[model samples]
Target: MDQAVCCYRHPDRETGIRCTRCDKPICPECMVNASVGFHCRDCVNQRGGTHVQPRTIAGGSVTSDPFLITKILIGLNVLVFVLELALGDRIVDDFGLYAKCVDLQTLQPARCGVSDGEWYRVLTSAFIHERPSPVHIGFNMLSLWWIGAPLEQRLGRSRYIALYFVSALGASAAVLVIAPGALTIGASGAIFGLFGATAVYMRRMRYDMRPVIALLVLNIIFSFTWANVSWQGHLGGLLTGTVLAIGMLYAPRERRNLVQWGTCAAVLLVTLAVSAIAVSQVTS
Candidate 1:
C-alpha cells in the first residue's frame, strides 16, 4: 500500500522530502531552502544538474559586494596616511620609490635598484603620500572612490586589482627610467591608470566619452603644471591601464580568462623587464 523513495543524488539516503519543482527526492545536503519548499541545488541553480554561474564583463564571478575591494583600498590608503603622520617622514624614507637603495645620510643611491632586491618599493611607494598635506590623500581617495568602484564592478575584484598593481608598476618603471634619483610617491599613477581604464570601458559600452576625456586632460595638465607632480608616473600608468583594459575587454569570450590573465602577465613582465634595464641605465 505504501512506497519509499531514496534521494536522487545519494542513492543510499532515504528521504521523504521532495523538491517542489522537480518532484525528485533530495537529501538535506542536496537541498536548498525555497520559499515554498526545499529545492534541489540543481533546481535552485536553474541549469539542470550543472549550475550556471553568473560572470562579470571580464569573466570574473558576479559578486554581491562589487565595491568591497575599492572600499578596502581606500581604507588602506587612509590608514597608511595616518601611519605616515604617526611614524613621521621616516616612513617615506624607507618605503618611497627610488630606483636604487639610497644612503639615508647623504640620500644618494647605494646600489642598483630592483635588480639588487629592494624591489618592493615599486609597488609600496604608490601607497605612500606626503605627510603634511591632506590635499594629496584627499584628492586621491576621492578619485579612487569615484573611478575605482565602477571599474571594480565591471572587471570584478581579481582583474581590477591586477590592473591596479600593474599600473603601479608601470608608473614605477617610468620613475626609475626618467627620474631614478628622485623620490617618487603617491596614488596618482594608479588613479591615472583607473582613468585610462574608465575611458576604454566607456568607449566599449558606447557611453559618451567627452566627460572622461575632459577630466583626464585636466588632470594631465595639473600633473605637469603643479609643482612636485610626477607626470612621468601618470603617463606611464595611463598607457599601461589603457593597454591592459583593451586586452581584458576585447578578449574572445571562449578563452576569456586565459587571454585576459595572459595579457596581464605579459604586461607585468614587460614592465619588470623595462625596470631592470632602467636600473642599469640609471645606476650606471
Candidate 2:
C-alpha cells in the first residue's frame, strides 16, 4: 500500500491537494486558488511578488484604477459643501482663506476672518466655497472629476495627493502674498494644478499639447475677466504643478526614483519657504 502524503505546512494533516507551481503537498488552509489549480501560500506569495508592478515616485503600488482617490476627494468636497449649506455662512467665514493682515474685529458681522493663529485656513479654504454661489462649488468639483482621474493614474495615489496639496498651498501662498486681505475659497487652484500636470505629462510624452494649452489660456483669460476669480491662485497652482510634472515625467531612467522624489521635495520646500516669507511679511 502507498503511504499517505502529509501537508508541508501541517504535517499532521494529510491531503491530496498540492501546490500548482511547486507541486508540494499542502493542507486546505495553506492552499490558494489558482487559475489551473491550488497553490500553497509560499508559492502564491512568490508569484505575486514576481508579478508586482514597479513602484511610483512616492513608493506606492501602481494601479490601473484611479477612481478610488479621485472619488474620495470629490466626496470630501461635496460633504463639506453640504455642511456649509446646512450650517449657514458661519462655516465659510471660519474656513475661508483670508489675508493675515485683515483685521477680523473691523468686519460688520464679527469674526468673519481668521484670528491671529488660525493658520489652518490655508488647507481648509480649499474645501469650502462661496456660500451664495452654488456655481463655484459646481464648477470646481466638475473640473476635479474631469482632470483628477487621469492625473491620479499617471502619478499614482500618493504622488497625486501630494501634488494636489502642494498646488493648494501654492495657491494659498499666492493669496497671502498678492491679496492677503481678500477672502478666497474653492478648489480651483488644485483643479488648475491637475490641468497643468496633465498638460506637462502630455507634452513630455510628445502628445499634442494644443488642447491643454488652449484650455489653460482660456481659463487664465477667464480668471482676469471674471469678477470673483483669483488670478494669482490660478497662476501659482499652474506653475507649481507644471514644475512637479516635469520632474516626475522627465527624470533620467538610471536614477528616476531619486530624481522624481527629490524634485517633488524641492518644490515643496520652496513653496513652504515662500509661504513663510509671506506670512512674516503679513504679520510684520
Candidate 3:
C-alpha cells in the first residue's frame, strides 16, 4: 500500500513524512530520525547536523512530545500572569475577571460577582495573581524547569504532563478548602508536586534526599511566613507529587502502560477530590 506521507507544515499536502526543517518530502534515502523526530537532510543541516537526543529518549519509552510539553505549559502560565497584571484594577472595571475566593458566610467576591465560582476558580486561580511580579513568575518557571525536565525524561511525556495538571488542580483544591475567598495564583502548587516527586525518587533510590527535602521544607516554611506566597498551593502540590511519584515508581513494572498511567492518574484525581471536599467542609 502506498501510504501518503503528510507534510509537517502543510496539512493539505499528501506525501510521506516531510523534513522537520526544510518541509521537503523525504523518502527513505533522505529521512533521518532525529533525537526528537524524523527529519530530512536539509532540515538536519539547518539544525546544525544531527539532533542531540537526550539520554532519556534514547533509552526511555516516554514519548518525546510530552517531554517538551513543560515549555508550553510554563509559557502559558507566564502569559496568563502577564494578562492579569496588565488588566490590574481595570480587571474589575473592564473584564469580569474577579477572585473566586469568597467568605463562606458572606461571599464578598461573589457578592460583587467577582468570584466566578469554586470550580472555575479551581483552574483560573492558578493563572491569576497580584501583579505580574518577576519574583512570582521566576520562582515558578525555575521550579517547573528544574523538576519537569528530569521527571518528563524519567516518566515519559504523558505521565509527566498529567502529573502537572493533576497537581495544579490538587493545589487549587487545597487553597479552596483553606481559604474560601482568598485570591490565589501562580504555579507554586505544581512546583510543589515536582518537589514531592523528587523527594519520592530520592527516597526510592535510597539516595540522600536530605538536601532536596531541606530545601522543600525551608521553602514551605517560608511560604507560611511570606505574606504573598500561597502556602496552601505549595502544600497541595507537594502532597500530590509525592503520592504520584509513589504510584509511578512502586507499581508493578510488568503492568501494562495504561494500567500504570491510570494508577498515577487515579491518585491525582482522588487527591484533588479529597482536598476540595475537605476545603468545603472546613470553610463551611
Best by TM-score: 1
| Residues 62-169, model 3: lDDT tens digits | 353644778887888777767767767544232322234344587453443223333554555555445545777787788788878777766666667777878877
Candidate models: Cα lDDT each = 0.84, 0.76, 0.63
Please give, for residues 77-196, the per-residue lDDT of candidate 1 as tens digits: 889999999999877877889776667799766764464677998998999888788999999999999999989987878999999999999999988888887889999898889999
Error of 1 at 55 (Å): 1.6
Comparing 2 with 3 on TM-score, the higher-scoring candidate is: 2
Per-residue lDDT for 33 in model 3?
52
Q: Any idea what lDDT model 2 has?
A: 0.76
Model 2 lDDT at residue 37: 55
- In candidate 1, stretches whose alpha carbon ends up further than 4 angstroms from where it belongs are 1-51, 101-108, 111-116
Task: Tell me the lDDT of model 1 at 95.
Answer: 80
RMSD of 3: 12.4
- A best-first ranking of the candidates according to their TM-score comes to 1, 2, 3
TM-score of each: 0.80, 0.76, 0.67
**Candidate 1, after superposition: displacement of residue 106 in Å?**
4.8
Cand. 3 TM to true fold: 0.67
